[model samples]
Target: MNDIRVSDATQGAAKSAGRKRLLQWLHQIVFVGPATFFFILIVLIPFFLGVYYSFTDWNGISRNINFIGIENYTHILTKDPDFRNAFWFTVRFTVVGILLTNLLGFVLAYVLTKPIRTRNMMRTIFFMPNMIGGLLLGFIWQFIFIRGFAAVGEATGIGLFNLPWLGDRATSFWGIVIVFVWQTAGYLMVIYISSLNNIPKDVLESAEIDGATRMQVIRHIILPLIMPAVTICLFLAISWAFKMFDLNLALTAGGPFKATESVALDIYNEAFTNNRLGLGTAKAVIFFIIVAIITTIQVRATKSREVEM
Candidate 1:
């Protein structure tokens, strides 16, 4: 009887453990199930479908699609000058945009973090551009470039303002860069400010007492400590600059002999304008791979530099 009672107790405990495990799993499934379902339904399905369609000769409106097996990719690499130019343009824009935005953002953050009477108002003024939609901002700036600048030039006789900003290749390139930096820098400034505020006051005071100059403290202490913020800012800047479309569309629409066309805009024109859906999808796949590789490397490199407080 004693043996039988011990066996029953052990069996009961095992059953209880099994039930608890089952309940935990059920709870997780309940909470995570809907999001997983939607993601698989929406993002995963469309992505796989797009990948499949990329290898075919589908015009995006046809019922029949024939598999072409890398022909589109080959053409994009060798025969397509437009795509090449657009890719080159995107590379240049991304490089310049990243450097300028990050530099300006850090400067703004450094200044605004100081105790100033008008810092809050200045911050709001700087960040207001980001609140406007990209397309809308592009149009607004377009008018400013076309009319506002002309008027100012007439009044002030400034050669810089009199030039055709949206009509020339060099000016259009810089015009896009200016708008991009203006729209994006403030957001990065906010991120940097947060990171700046979190630095321990004692460390800064110690550096000051040790006779460190402002630049020395920033270089040796602040930059290393706030590197995580740098990583986030770089990632955001890279993505924004690389995939810029709406602003490119509304501002210049790849004007001045398609000099400012970005890879994204080229893909759009290929897919819809030229009705080369398969080829466009191929370009998109290539674009996706490049962006993924670049962002991964950037994150890994930056994360390695992050220092503990």
Candidate 2:
């Protein structure tokens, strides 16, 4: 009789445990199911469809698409001077934009973290540009470069603002860079602020007690502690600079002989302007591969430098 009771108890406990596991799984599904479903529907489906269309010769309005294996890729690599120029231009812009944005962001973050009378107001002023949409900001800056700068130059007799800011290749390139850095630096500053705030006060105090100067403390202690923020900032800045399009469109429109055309803009032009969906998709695929590889390498490199708290 005791053996029978023991067997019944064990069975009951196993049933209860199974029910608990089932409930937990249902709870997870209830929370995570909708997001997973939407992501697969929106992002994954479109991506795979784009991949399929990249190998075909499909115009935007075509009902028939013939598969042309690797032709588009070959043409882009060997024969397309515009694409080559755009790629090189994008690379240069990205390098300069990333460095300037990160440096400015870090500097702003460092300064604002100090106890100042108008720190909050200053942060708000700095971050206001980021809140504006890129397209709108581009248009605003366009006017400023054209009319506002001209007015200032006339009044002050300064040659700096009077130059043809967007009409020349050199000025157009640097004009976009200046706008990009100004717009993006503030956003990265917020990330740095959060990271800086999280650093332990005791660690900083200890460094100071050990006779570390302001520069030494920042170089050795503060930087290492906030490296995770650096990783995030680098990733964000790289993505922004590499994929810049709206600002390029509204500001320069690849003008001054297409000197400032980005790969994103090139892809847009190839598809919509030229009505070559297949070629555009091919360019997009190539762009994706390059960006993925570069960002992955950057993330891994930065993560390797992250010091444990």
Candidate 3:
């Protein structure tokens, strides 16, 4: 009887354990199943399809898809001068845009953090541009560049405003740069402001109580403490610069001899406009690889420099 009772108890315990395991699995499926399903259904499947399509001569409409191996990649790499031009243009724009956006953002953040009477108002005014859609903002700035600046130049006799901003290669590049900086800097400024606010007041006080000048405190204490914000801002800036499409579309439309054509826009034109979906997909794959490499490097480098309080 004692042996039988012991065996019954062991079986009961095993049943309980099995029930608990079942419940745990049910919980996970209930919570995580939908998101996983959608991701696999939407993003994962489409991405793999795109990869497969890149090797085939699919014009995005034909019923037939012929596999041509690496011909598309070879053609893009060797013969596509437009792609090369767009790549270089994007590179230059990204570099300049990153620098200006971050610099202006940091400056605005630093100044706005001070106790000024109109600080809140100034912040609102600065950030209002970001709230506008990129397409609308580009159109608004187009008017400003074409008409408003011309008027201002006429009124004030400023040659800078009178130049053909969107009609020339050099001026069009700078015009886009100006609008991009104006649109993006405020968002970065807000991020910087949050970072600036989180810094311990005691540290700044101690630095000040020492013989540290304003610049010294900022350089040593403030800058080091805010490296995380820098990392985030740089990543965002890089992504924005690289993926700039809507503004490029609305503002320049790759005009002035395609001087302002970006890689995104070029890929778009190649795929849809020229009906070379396979080649376009090849370019997109190359672009994706480049962006991934750049962002990874930037994140790692900045992450290494982040200092903990």
Best candidate, lDDT? 1
* lDDT (Cα, tens digit) per residue for candidate 2, span 180-223: 99999999999999999999999999989999999999999999
Over 3-103, each residue of candidate 1 has an lDDT whose tens digit, in order, gives 99999999999999999999999998999988899999999998989898889989999999999999999998999999999999999999999999999
Deviation (Å) of 268 in candidate 2: 0.8
Lowest summed lDDT across 10 adjacent residues in model 3 is found at 45-54
Alpha-carbon RMSD to native, per candidate = 1.3, 1.3, 1.8
In candidate 3, stretches whose alpha carbon ends up further than 4 angstroms from where it belongs are 1-17
Task: Report how far off residue 109 is in candidate 1 (Å).
Answer: 1.1
230: Cα error in model 2, Å: 0.3
- Model 1 TM-score, 2 decimals: 0.96
Model 2 ranges with Cα > 4 A deviation: none
For all candidates in order, the CA lDDT equals: 0.96, 0.95, 0.94
Off by over 4 Å in 1: none
lDDT of 1 at 262: 96
What is candidate 3's lDDT per residue for 1-309, written digit by digit as tens?
999999999999999999999999999999999999999999999888888888989999999999999999899889999999999999999999999999999999999999999999999999999999999999999999999999999999989999999999999999999999999999999999999999999999998888899999989999899999999999999999999998999899987889999999999998999998988888998999999999999999999989999
Clashes of each: 0, 0, 0
Better of 2 and 3 by TM-score: 2
